[model samples]
Target: MLRYQVVESFLSINGEGKRAGQLAVFLRFAGCNLKCSYCDTMWANQPDVAYTWMTKEEIYEIVRQSGAKNVTITGGEPLLQKGMKELLAFLAEDESLTIEIETNGSVDLTPYLSISDRVVMTMDYKLPGSGMEDRMNLSNLKKLRTVDTVKFVSGSREDLIRAVQIMEEYTLRGRCACYLSPVFGRIEPVEMVEFMKERQLTGVNLQIQMHKVIWDPEMKGV
Candidate 1:
């Protein structure tokens, strides 16, 4: 009888991270713990937003219908949902499916550790531009593995400085794959690349939001 507050679920090519251009089923959960300045999905956190309350079986059926081998569970902070453990547990049954969750890195990841081997956590380390960087649970960085990814959405040169500091502090490159992406239309990818080159920053990749390029930047759902 457990149900998840789902804002929307659709099949789309992953627009970011290491999986960019990969077809996957995305489940956008409702609600969030922080309000970032550039959040495109603020509507997902609004109390009055329209959403479907779906049970595990219902969610599984949707994924089955998508016929995608990869599933991305994103949010307004998916960890805020009560039934995520159950939903993840259900999804884990499909050994052939690769499940990934995108979190704001402010929530405790321990709850999902049991299935760590099966689930990949794309933890976004919020930067100064987000205005919610203080809320980041630094300990979560220790939970990462090579299978997971840690990302920084840089909105300015200052933000990349913070990312570099953290990257060195945690030796994140050796811990897991680290990615640096310019905030859509705010910071340019070329600028980030130059910065990395000048500093001889190693082990961090420059990524772009491929979905925004393939479709109208303003378009939602693939």
Candidate 2:
């Protein structure tokens, strides 16, 4: 089995995106293909941190002991891992468990779509301020199933405008929910909500980092 840079394994509330506040065991994989400027998880992208490499069996044992009915496959970029698929398959043995994955909205997830029926994909679409617009997989947006969702984190009026325009331009599937999240402290959630209302942007919803607002924003592992 290939080695995995296991960042942290702890039982915590799912802080953002879907399944928020649900009991979850997060697998924060280390390493990302794109470097977004607003990325709060920039720590995971670094290469120097100490990591533990474990096989699928070892990971399952840890997850079982955690007593978490939900699992969120997060990262720097969990999909970047070579055996991520195999690991997901192994976890699928637990029928009642809900699996979720957070991606940068740049990788090809078609491969995992078939096996991960219960997996809710929280895909982050890069806005202009993110400095990674070119890295986006536009095709991946169209390929997303109803279970998959697209998210755009806006830092300014320009960023929000672009996000709405792109969704309309691509004729993004109506089945997918369009998530518009602010840059936390950088952008006001109320202002963002008002903008969406004034523009009458259909298929749009607001998202805030609940854990950040309720707990220590600087903390990690829930």
Candidate 3:
């Protein structure tokens, strides 16, 4: 049986991405390859973290019962898990669902691209503040489509500047949904807006984690 190390699963509004503010089923998987300085889900990334082993059928049933059309497969770093493509393929069988895979910048996305037309990607572009910038797979940027998203979680002005440079270099604005999100308390939204205006970074959206605002920042399971 194919099983996944699931840290948590819940129904909630997508706090980020193009589907932000819309209700979605979140499947948070366990483990990650890189440690970001601003990672809020560090508790779920620990080597010995408590997790439930779930088959793809079990996971699909949870989403089916949630009555949500949008599904977000997030993680400490979702792509690191084995059988991820198979799991995604299973989920994709439900044509009515919109599956969004949230991946840290390190992993290669090419392997999962053919899984389904309904599967979209929300990849991160870790900045210097994350301390995992060098681990980013730059090639993944080219793979993003208009339906996909590239999120830049900025903690400092330097990070914001680097984000703009990368966006320009990759011509990301027209290629996909580019988002600049503040690292919770590190940088303010107004500050990010100002930076965007100053740089004339047109077409990029500034997103705030709505779940953190609706509930406690540390709260789990929505």
**TM-scores, all models, native as reference:** 0.97, 0.94, 0.98
Model 2, C-alpha of 191: deviation from truth (Å): 1.2
Best by TM-score: 3
Residue 199, candidate 2: alpha-carbon lDDT: 92
**Tens digit of per-residue lDDT, candidate 3, span 2-105:** 78999999988998888889999999999999899999999999999999999999999999999999999998998888899999998999999999999997
What would the per-residue lDDT of candidate 2 be over residues 1-222, giving only the tens digit for each residue? 666778887788887766777889888888999999888888878888657888888888888998988888888889999988888887887887878889998888887888867876888889999999999888787777777778899998999999988888876638676789889778888889889899987678788888888878888877
Ranking by TM-score: 3, 1, 2
Give the lDDT ranking, best first.
3, 1, 2
Q: Give the higher-TM-score candidate: 1 or 3.
A: 3
Off by over 4 Å in 3: none
Better of 2 and 3 by TM-score: 3
Scored against the true structure, residue 47 in model 3 reaches a CA lDDT of 91
Best by lDDT: 3
lDDT of each: 0.90, 0.84, 0.92
What digit string (tens of lDDT, one per residue) describes model 1 on residues 102-218?
A: 999999998897874778889999999999999999999888888889999999999999999999888898789899988888988889999999878887888888888888877
Q: Give the TM-score of candidate 3.
A: 0.98
